[model samples]
Target chain A: MIHRFLFHDINEGLIRHAKRYVLVVIVVVITCSMIDSMSAYFMDYFGEYWSPIEYGINEFYGRYPFVFDINSTDKFTIPFGWVLIYLFLAYMIGDYIYKDMNGYGMYMMIKSKKRWYWWISKCLWCVAVNVFYFGLLWISNIAYSWMKHGDIAFYQESDLRMSYYGFGFDNMGMPKLLLVVIVMPLLVGIVQSILQITLTLIFNSVATMTIIAGILMLSCYYGSIYIPHSYAMLIRYFSNESDPDFVAVDAGTGIAVLGIGIVAMVVMGYMIFRKKNVISNR
Target chain B: MKIELKNISKVIKKNNVLEDINYTFTGGCVYGLIGKNGCGKTMLMRLIAGLIYPTSGSVCINDKILGKDISFPDSIGILIENPEFLNDYTGFENLKLLAGLQKNVDEQEIKDTLTSVGLDYNDKRKFYKYSLGMRQRLGIAAAIMGKPEIILMDEPINAIDEDGVAIIRDLIRGLVDKNRIIIIACHDKEEMDYLADKKILMSSGKIVKEMIV
Candidate 1:
């Protein structure tokens, strides 16, 4: 019976506190992904059609590659919008709990006998929101691929395996691309969501958002497992067979970094939230 | 259902919102907690609701410490400060969600509670659309709905009309029980005198007077 009530409260957290972000997450995810893909589309198809399409063409480098190619550094230009999804995703995790804390949170806590149940409910709702947000973006990537390439885009993706997609790095196959493009982003969203929430409880919302985004922006430069955001960007791990500056962390190492970070944040967040006073959000 | 306080002092940001104070309340009675704006009336209610912790003391219910033995009151109905609720949901929907927390009140009881507060049971209006008076009524309905043993209300009749206030007066009077405790903080001294079986006046977090009518 207690478990039923606990799950019911978990479901209530999703319906009340977390459901409103669906549109915001969807809009940001699709908007950022499309801008990156469409820029590449115009440069690849339009720029090529305007110049020349010859039987024997020696392309010096892939001027623009597909957005989900897992080797496209061209998408990293201009505000680094390729990683901009974290700007909203991190904010969602950072502010969702605090906003509700400032809202009807005290009333709900007074109703329930267990304060920890409220903390657990919010965490569950956040995970559900992160997974749904990333799943929607992954579907958008697949649709873009099917539209750009002919039918059976997976088969066509194999041809990109040996070619330099961007930054003189060899493109990965469809299976590996799915792992990098879809799965890695989902893990990153989960990790960032949990980490930012914990930080928000420890600090204020503005400071936490800035801190998470700053670390991620720094990862774009370092591309090291020490910076967890480096693993979120798939293109960082894939490199040309002949590139000199390529520093690749094995996929296991990348996953472990994010996975360990997530566990640590969950434990820390529970401790902080359990002790927090729900007094008018002060 | 008895409440006991032991040197309950809450200090926030170097300011003692509640100074060292001790009081006990028993069931089958109405408690009128009267005080000025910042006299720790609301802070006292919050400590009892387990929303905030005390800096130097403890609150116990029936000999069980508030923070250690029970995280919050076992079955409490509270409307602290401004009676915050989900703004997007309809009034009935909000009550229904809170009711699900304890599973003690059914749909008929919720509808009756709304109607008892003079709110339309079938009104589909969301909480954001309600006037200030209706919001206060809904807060009262939520507090007294599930038949909780303890009900703590701060400014329960604020913004209510004359007729609504009369109805609330009668409703509060009718809810006294041997095992049920009701504590209210309000600015209206006449209503407190008329409705409270015992009135406790506070000044700067210290109990100045305790009157048993």
Candidate 2:
């Protein structure tokens, strides 16, 4: 039963979509991190210029790729790669679940015997993908740091802006930085993925995709860290652009809320899945 | 295993697929359901397999309600709509993947089941390459391989040749003495007459006639 329900489902999940997930993460994360690192080292237009090492760490981990200096006249724009990652992850998961539910409903569900088990297996697969994707992103950040500041042990940020130094990088070591940025983003990604997959089952796939995309966009536009998807964004939650002063929630609270949100989404999704008549409507 | 359906009805988008179906199927007999296209034969078989829940009533096996006591049948093999499997995998590989889920049957058993269905167990041809008849044969093999307590088949020989049809007829006919419940849906009346110990005729989501042969 375990083999059929849990292991096999996870194995198939990893084999089928994991490649696409990993390939996208690696290419985008690496390219974006490298570009941000290069700009930090080669170009210094601001009064608050730090070494490329400091810039690399700050650019990779900063919520907004937009320069944070008060004197900068450039319109603020962060790396769009982060946005694409969240959107694409939700899309892949939602598409897969909805297709399975509609296309071959009889073949898979009947063989599995337990509806909840089949759904849970899917959830497990989503979690695995999210973790691996974020883990690779963390590595890309590390690489950027290494290339910009060879053998650098300490972090330096926004020498012209005193507050920037203390906000995220003041006296912080690599270990602490990793915990705040890498681990938190992964937890948040898993949470959002869960919500997306379950909602796709409940509503139309396009509607669910659009809803998730709208929420993330609203969070970014409003500079509010309250969106569930925002929790997964290390920079947005910590140092938002629209509401930089609004730091009402910390990492601990953010993680807790997101975790609770996952439980709630799963509960609601499971209820709908159990009661819904999963026939071949397609 | 004895299967019973009490006042079962299914309405999808207001299309009454099956309405007020009441049935009691005992083991050790082969039951054939005959109906025109769009009738509820396929829906009824799905209800027995616990693939889709009824809009109104419940299905019970040995007095245990499906939705309450179990989400799906504890032990059953089904080929509902199409003879489908992973297109990339060979016939043996497909069977092996599913059989590995329960470990209920070994490699030798899967090979034997494929052979029993007149499929070459060693055939390396992928599922995508198989003709409609071969795919039907594979579906039949999957539905009956482990010999679960209950078997649900829909149009099991829709695309097979004459000899293949004869072989499947004999294979299905041989299952009556095993004390298992077999539910089959087909359009061929002669085949239904020859194989099914009981026959049911359905039209417009209702059972029109039932005869014990």
Candidate 3:
């Protein structure tokens, strides 16, 4: 019975999400355009053929570790492509549970006969959305490469990436590319989305969403290894891999941190939501 | 089956919504929770449905305490406040989706419930295009679909027309049985007198009067 309810709930979420398919596709097209144009500009300037992995690296490659200097003045610049992708995904998925609780979600909760089932179904729903969102990102990039007649391979111009993004890439492999593009971003997306849902249970939707967006922005401004958002940026890994002052959080550490973060947030949310007084404040 | 609320009280933002409510609801009866807008009728309903926990009380159903032995009533249905559904789904589809949770009722049961509430079972209009009365009918249909042991409806007839109200009144009356409990929260005193076996009048978060109908 629980499985049946979960299946239906997930289907409901995906169906509702389908209404936004056109909008999501448009966002993807615009994002892909931006990334492709930037790659073309860099290729024209450097006079070299860039692989698809270079575009992927550039998309996930955020700013290097920030060092605060009192004497030298430098403006904090955000990685537009990276921030746009994460922030947009956050906004897309951050409000469904909150809104649903006031609406049909409460009805479904009573019907499911267990609060844990409802919460778990929502967690799984978030995971599904993140998967779909990231899958679209990958497919969009592939389609863009195909359209532009670009080489699609697990290869990166190490020198170009190093001089341009200030990162040291000793070697590039398929595992590394997949880790950065698919695994890391997807993990962060699921973790942040779950965190937002948990927070919305305690706060209003606007406040909760703002808190999530603020965390992402702060991660961009300061590349502290302690910040989980830093692990999503590939530049952080390459830049601090050899730096003695910073402990390089590799893909394994990121997966561990984000995986644990997902479990902890799920448990905490279940504990709070099970005892919560569900009222229609919205 | 019996539902006993032992000294129920709820405080929201430091304001007492339901103050020390102690009541026992038994099977084979229709209960009318009568009050104005914010006199705790809906809060009392919420407490009973296990949608909200009482600050210093426990809702016990058949000796099983809510929040301890069970999270909610084992078999219960509710339509609190306004009816909310996915706007893109048809009325039948909405009920079908909800009915999938328990899997206790089939498509025929859902279609019958819709017809019982004066809604066309084959209506193809999306819920967003439904009128106020049609929405109310769908809400009532959802609450009563599976013949739950306990049913809670708040303002179940707010936007219903005269003919629709008559049809629903008869529907509720026909649902009375030896093993079922039906509770309705409404503002119409006449309708309460007509339908409820007992009328509970609440004022300022306390039960001010109880009249046998």
Best by TM-score: 3
In candidate 3, which residue ranges exceed 4 Å CA deviation? A2-12, A19-42, A45-47, A149-159, A166-168, A224-226, A239-244
Model 1 chain B poorest 10 in a row by lDDT: B79-88
Docking class of 1: medium
Worst 10 residues of 2 chain A by lDDT: A47-56
In candidate 1, how many Å is residue B12 off? 1.3
lDDT of 1 by residue, B13-105 (tens): 788888889898899998999988999898899889887788878999889998889889888888765676777788898888777766678
Interface RMSD of candidate number 1: 2.4
Clashes of 1: 0
DockQ of 2: 0.48
DockQ of each: 0.53, 0.48, 0.76
Docking class of 2: acceptable
Model 1 residue pairs with clashes = none
Residue B125 local lDDT, model 2 = 97
| Cα shift from native, residue A17, model 2 (Å) | 3.9
- DockQ of candidate 3 compared with the true complex: 0.76
iRMS of candidate 2, Å? 2.4
- A63-152: candidate 2 lDDT, tens digit per residue: 542335687676655446556767766755657666556433345566667788667766777787777666655555555456654633
| Cα deviation of B45, candidate 3, in Å | 0.6
